[model samples]
Target: MSIKNRLIAMNFFQFFVWGAWLITIANFWFGTKQWEGTQFGLVFGTMGIASLFMPTLTGILADRWINAEKLYGILHILYALVLFYLPQIETPGNFIYVMLLAMCFYMPTIALSNSISYTALKNSSDSDVVKDFPPIRVWGTVGFIAAMWLTNLSGNKATAYQFYIAGIAAILLGLYAFTLPKCKPQHTKAEKSSFAESLGLEAFKLFGTYKMALFFIFSMFLGGALQLTNAYGDVFLDEFKNVPEYADSFVVKYSTIIMSISQVSETLFILAIPFFLKRFGIKQVMLISMVAWVLRFGLFAYGNPTDGLWMIITSCIVYGMAFDFFNISGSLFVETSTNAKIRSSAQGLFMMMTNGFGAVLGSFTSGWAIEKYFTHDGERDWHNIWLSFAAYSLVIAIAFAVLFKHKHNPNDVANVSH
Candidate 1:
């Protein structure tokens, strides 16, 4: 098989492992196990908690001690084992601990996968990562959509069977990773550095750089915006079932699939990243993402399952731009800015800010803010909730425009090389 195809397969299962359960886990937790809503909130928080440290820690290992692919394989296997144990647990408390462990094993591999892909692409004389990667990465979104469909269609969305599908795929992917192109540690004995530097902790010093620090700060804020939709998009749609007039609408019955349109749109937008980055540069591309977030929430604020369904659909479509432009382009920005020696570590820091601290910030603050301000009596005011979120995104976009200092350089497209 060709290298591109191999990487595509890797990306597919990488996200498939996540998609099989992520969107549907709420059903399993609430519908099947009858867990407390407060604890359920913490369940999603596991991703943030795990992302905080595991990705950077594993990135260090990939940079200094182990081959990137090998470490990637190990983490997935460990993740699968924990996932497989999840169905056996009876209590919500136990499930949270198990999920935390599963996240710890799984989150770091996201950065590792990027490291492996970039290294492989750079080594290929025929491949340009900026041009080739988005196409390959688009499959991960496809995989996510495919997994969501399989879970729902197979009647496993509200059952423990969802974990089985994810766990089995994870094990297969773990084994397949061993056969992938080897990504050996770059910092060998020939390179000289101090003990702290030898530990690959130098990646943390990226905070000391003005440009990189501001980029990460904005990334974290955007990450929070991404969580706003993910955390509430479905619930917003599902709540329409509460309205007698709109109870039978397609949006409510097929809320998951409706939300899947975002992922579907992601596949298209991912393929557009190369051109957008070439035309606009990284800062502008991310700024565009911030604006998309504004539209995403604004559309949702007034959308209904009936006459206003277009707004909902449009929000999902806008989601594609809001998500991909920052995530994919931001990674490319990291690739062009950082030294080769700390490539994996730099990716980890990006994930840390966006998925790690950013996710937690979004999840916790949004939940609290919604309850305190958007909820009246016992009912949630989704309109106000979404409006607040839209306002937040607009603020982020304006702040990002004023604060982040960078000039669009066309040569940046070519500079993303080893």
Candidate 2:
């Protein structure tokens, strides 16, 4: 296979492992197990908890001791082992620990995957990472969409089969990772580094800068919003089955497929990031994403499978921008700004903020808030649930506008692509 095809395959299964279950796991938790909302929230929180430390720790290893591909492969194999063990657990409380273990092995790979892809593209002769990476990354979204469709069509969305599919795919990807081009550690001991710098802690200095610091802080706030839909979107639509009027609706029957539209939207939006990031600065593009988030949640608050279905559809479409703008742009921002030696660690820091602290904040708080305020009598008031989320997003957008200070340097945007 050509280098591009190999990277494409890598990106495809990278997200495929996640797409198989991330959105639909709520169905397994709430529908299959009928667990408590708070515990279920912690289930998503596992990714956040793992992201808090694992990504940074692994980033250090990748920078210092291990080849990126080798580390990436090892994590996915460990992840598959944990996932294979998932269906055996019978309770939500017990599920959290195991899920956290799975996430520890899985979350860092996301950052590592980026490091791997970026390294491969930059190494390829005559290739432009800015121009080439987005196209390759789009397959990851395609992979995610494919997994959702498979889980839903195979009659396994609410069953343990989703974990099996993910586990099997993960094993395949893990083994495949070993065959990919080498992504060796950039920092070697011959540099004569100090203990702190030796640990790849140099990237942490990005926090000392006001711009990067505020950027990560807002990334955390938005990260809090990221999993809300993944945690509840499917169950929200599936809940319509309780109403006789909408019980037979297409959405209620195939909520996972419908939710996959967001992933579909991601593919298109992922392509557009290069344009948006270039035309506007990272800050402006991110501001647009925050606004899109408001519309996304606001639309969902009123959407139904019937007359209000357009709102639902629109909300899903909005998700692509709401997600890709921040995540892809933020990563590019990190890539362009940071020192090459610490880039992996810097990417891990970004993941830590968005997926780690942000995810934990979003998961734990949203879970508690929803149970306390919007859920009653074993039913969720999704409208209020989404509206409150919209309000949270709006606040973040406004704060970001006032606090973040960066002018669109065409050269910096130029750095992202070249």
Candidate 3:
């Protein structure tokens, strides 16, 4: 295969491994194993725990010692091994430990994938990477959607077998990674520096700036909103089956497929971001995201599998705005605002706030709320659960609108155009 095709395939399997189980695993926990709600919170929070430091540690290893592609391959292989063992584990505590280990290996590859792609494209003689990569990266979202659909169609959405599917894809990608063009380590030799500097700790300097600090702090809060729906949306839809009128609806019967619309919309909306950012600037773009989150949850709060199907559909569509608006725009904000020397590390820190800390907070709090207020005799009170989440989003939105100060400069937006 050509280099482009190889990279695309890598991106496909990258997300395919995640898509196979990420959204549907709550069903596996709730329906199959019948685990406690708090246990599921801990299980989902493993991603957040791993995200706390795995990416930075792995990035250091890739930069200073190992070839990027080789480390990527190794991580995937380890991740696949963990996935293979997941089906055999019966207890939630054991499951959480294994998943944490799995995430430790898996999360770093998200950044590594970008690193490898940028390296490959920069080295290529035929194309300019800046112009070529966005189009190529779109295929990653396509792969993610395909995996979600496949999981639903294969009857693995609510089964441990979703891990098996993700595992197999990960292993295949691990082997395939060896054949890709090699990415060299960034460091040639050890050099003396401050304790923080040696650890890629210079990224912390951004915390000294008031605006950067607030942006990151709010990013963490918003990041909390990011994973709550993914962890519970399918299970929420499936919960409607307990109601007599909606028990037999198509949505309750196939919640995974219905939820995949969010991914589909994500791909479509990502293309519009350049235009949106150009017109509104990052602050307004982020505000739009916060509002989208409110709608995303409120719709779910009011939606049902039968009569309120449109609300559910609207919730899924708004997810595109909620997710992409924050993540992509946040990345652009970092790209534009930070110095070149610590750009990669700064980006990693941004992810740490949103995905790492944010995910942990979201999973644990939402889990606790669901258990306390939304469950009665093991049946879910999805209406109240979703309403609580909507309220949380509203708080975050209001806080961000008042706290995050960025002047919308038409020229700054124009820079992205050129």
Candidate 4:
């Protein structure tokens, strides 16, 4: 295959492994297993918990010792093994332990895949990586959408079979990873460093700067909002199945397909990012994202599959802006703000705060809130649940606008293109 094809294949399989189960797993827990909400939160919390340390540790090893592709392969193989065991667990508590092990192996590979791709593209003499890479990366979103469709069509969206599907794809990708171009380690013994420094604790030094600290702190707060929708959106829609008038609606019956619209929007929005960041500085772009989040949850608060189809659709559309804007722009911000030496580790730290700490807090807290205030007679009080989320997002948006003080540097925007 050509290099472009290779990258496309890599992107496709990378997300194919995830798409098989990520959105649908809530259904597997709540619908199939009839597990408690808090237990479900624990299951998702494993991703956040693992994100705290696993990615950084793997990044260090990949940087200093193993080829990125080899490490990627090894992790996926291990992830596949763990996933194969997930379906056998009879209780949510035991499943949490198994899923934690799986996520430890799985989450790091997301960063590793990026590393391998950059290395491979740089080595390919014929490729213009900067211009070509985004297109390739978009295919990963396409793969995610495909998996959602498959899960919905196959009726596996609400069953443990989703894990089997993910495991199979992961195993296939693990084998395929061996054939990718080698990404050799860059560090030497002379460069061996302290554990703290290696993990990018240096970025914490930025916290002393008022603006930088506010940015990272708000990033944490917004990150808390990020996973909230993904963790609950499908469940929110699926909840409507109890309503006699809308229970049979295509959306409620096929919630995975409805949710896949968010991924579709994600793909388009990611491509638009370069233009947006260049046109509107980071602050405005991020502010736009916060506003989008308000709408995202607010719409969900009022929408139903029957009378409010447009609102539901609009919420999914806003999701693209809400998600891609923050995540991609935040990454570019990290790239621009930090020094080159610790850039990789700094990015890892950025992810740790958002995906790690923020996600854990969101999952557990949202679960408790839902179990307490949103569940009555086993039916979700979605109206109140969504309104509460909207209120939380509004507060974050207002605070972010008032605080995060970055002067819009037109020159910085121009420099990003180079």
Candidate 5:
């Protein structure tokens, strides 16, 4: 296969491993295991905990000690092993423990995958990373959607079999990674630096600037917004089964498939980033994302499995804009605004803010809020829960607009090396 195709396959299975379970795990937890909502929030928060440090730690290893692909493969293999163990755990505490280990092994690979792909593409004579990488990365979403479909269609959406599907795919992807193009350590022989610098801690200095400080703060807030749906969307639909009228509806049985629409929308939105970034600039694009987030949650607040199904579908479609605009454009903002010396570290800090701190905040707080205000007679008030989320996003959007300031520059797009 050609280099692009190879990278596309790598991206595919990389996320397929995740797609097999990420969105649907809530079902297995709530529907199958009958776990509490607050506890479930902590489960997803494991991603936040893992993201807090693992990526930076692994990046250090990949940058100085090992080939990126090799390290990437090793992590995936370990991840698969941990995932396989999930089927044996019965208690919530044990499940969280096992899941944390799995996340430790898996989350870092997200960044590593990008590193490997970017290096490979840059090394290829015909490849242009800025132009080519987006197309290749889109396949990762396709893989995720495919895995979600497989899980739902096979009647494994609420079973431990989802882990098996994910684990086996991870094992295969891990082995396949060995044959990928080499991405050697770039800083193997770098000048002497402090222990902190060696571990990319120097990126923390970016916080000294007002703009970056505000941006990272908002990133954390927005990061909290991300896990809300992923942690609850599937099971939220599944809960409709309690109503006899909706129990057999496709929305409940095929909820994951419906959720896949968000990923499909993600691919389309990913392609539009450059134009939006060029025309509207980063701040405006980000504001658009914030507004979209409000709509995403607001629509969900009113959506149901039957007559209100369009709201759910529209909410899923709006998810693409709400998600991609902030994530993609935010990455570009980080790429353009930071100095090359600390660019990688800055990127890591960005991830730490969103996936790490933001996720933790979102997971724990939302969980508590749901448990406190949205739960009664052991049933969740998903409508109020969603409206609360919408209100939160609206507040953030207003704060971001009033507080953050950046002049529009077309050159930011030009300099992106497309």
Candidate 6:
């Protein structure tokens, strides 16, 4: 296979591992295991906990000691092992611990995958990393959607088989990673060196800048917005099964498949980033994303699988903008703003904020808020829950618009494509 094809496959299996279980895991938790809400929230927070350190630690290893592909392969294999063991655990505490281990192995690989891809693409004689990589990355979402469809169609949406599916895909990708192009450590003997620098801690200096510090803070806040839907969206649809008329609806039967539409939208929105970034600049593009988040939650506040199905579908569609606008554009912003020496670490820092701290904050707080304010008589008030979330996003968007200050430079936007 050609280099692009190889990278595409890598990206595909990369997310396929995640898609198999992420959306449907709530079913396995709340539906199959009948776990408590607070614990379930902690379960999702595992990604945050893992992201808190593993990405930076691995980034250090990839930047200094190990080949990025080798490290990526090792983590995937470890992740597969943990995932395979997950079904045997009967308690929520054990499940959380095991899943946390799995995430420790899994989360860092996200950043590593990007590093490997960027390196391989940059090494290709005729390739442009910026222009070519997004197209390749879109397949990762395709892989995610494919896995979601597979789980939903096979009647494994609420079973341990979801973890098995993810495990199998992760192992396959682990082996496949070994065949990818090398991404050797960039650190050299000639460069000034210290223990902290060697460990990629220098990237923390970005926090000293008012712009980067505020950007990361907002990234955390938005990161909280992300998994709210992922954790509850499918369950939200599944709950409609309690209503007589909606009981037989396609959404109740195929909630995972319906949720896959968000990933489908991601593939398209990822392609539009370059154009949007060029025209509106990062600040405006991100503002658009925050606003989209408000709409995403607001629409969900009133949507149903029947008469309000359009609202649900539209919310799913808006998710692409809400998600990609911040994630992709934010990564690009980090890339453009940071020095090359600390780029990998900076990416890790960004992941730490959104996926790490943001995830923990979102998971715990949402769980608490839902249990405290949104639940009554053993039923969740999803309408008010979604409205509350929408209000949260609106507040963040307004604050961001007033606080973040960056002027668009045409040359900077143009440079991304080159």
lDDT of 2 by residue, 146-240 (tens): 99999999999999999999999999999999999999989977798877897679989998999988999999999999978778889899999
TM per prediction:
0.97, 0.99, 0.92, 0.92, 0.95, 0.98
lDDT of candidate 4 over 1-418, digit per residue (tens): 8878887888898988888998899998887888877678787788889888877677667766678788889899999999889999998788999899999998888767766666676678876543555677879889989988988899999887888888889998999999999888665567767776565455566668887778778787788888789789988898788889987899888998999998899899888877787678899999999989999999998998877999999999999899888877786676567654444455666777777887888888988888888888877788888889899989998999998888888667544333
TM-score winner: 2
Write down the RMSD of all candidates, one decimal each. 1.4, 0.9, 2.4, 2.4, 1.8, 1.2
Off by over 4 Å in 4: 122-130, 191-211, 339-341, 410-418
Per-prediction backbone clash count: 0, 1, 0, 0, 0, 0
Q: How many residue pairs clash in model 3? A: 0
Badly placed stretches (over 4 Å) of model 5 are 188-195, 338-344
**Model 1 whole-model lDDT (C-alpha atoms):** 0.89
Model 5 quality (TM-score): 0.95
State the displacement of the C-alpha of residue 249, model 4, in Å, after optimal TM-score superposition. Answer: 1.2
Predicted candidate 3 versus true structure: per-residue lDDT over 1-418, tens digit per residue = 8788889899889989999999899888988998877789887798888888887677667666678899999999999999999889988889999999999999888877876776787678785443455556667878888988988999888888899999999999999999989887655456666787676677788899999999989998998998898888888888788889888999988998899889888887777777787788899999999999999999998988767899999999999889988887786677566544454456667777887899899999888888888788877777888888899999989999898888888666444322
The most accurate candidate by lDDT is 2
- Candidate 1 per-residue lDDT, tens place, 1-418, comes to 9999999999999999999988878777766887755566677777888889989999888888899999999899999999989999998888889989999999899899999999999999899998999999999999999998898778887789989999999999999999999999988888889887887888889899998999999999998888778767776787788899999998877777888999999999999999999999998999999999999999999999878999999999999999999999999999998887888999999998988999889878876777677767657898888999999999999999999999999897778954
- Model 2 scores worst on lDDT over the 10 consecutive residues at 409-418
Candidate 3 lowest-lDDT run of ten: 409-418
Q: What are the lDDT scores of the predictions, listed in order? A: 0.89, 0.91, 0.83, 0.81, 0.87, 0.90
lDDT of 6 by residue, 88-151 (tens): 9999999999999999999998888877777787678888766787889999999999999999
Candidate 6 — which pairs collide? none
lDDT of 2 at 418: 49
Number of clashing pairs, model 6? 0
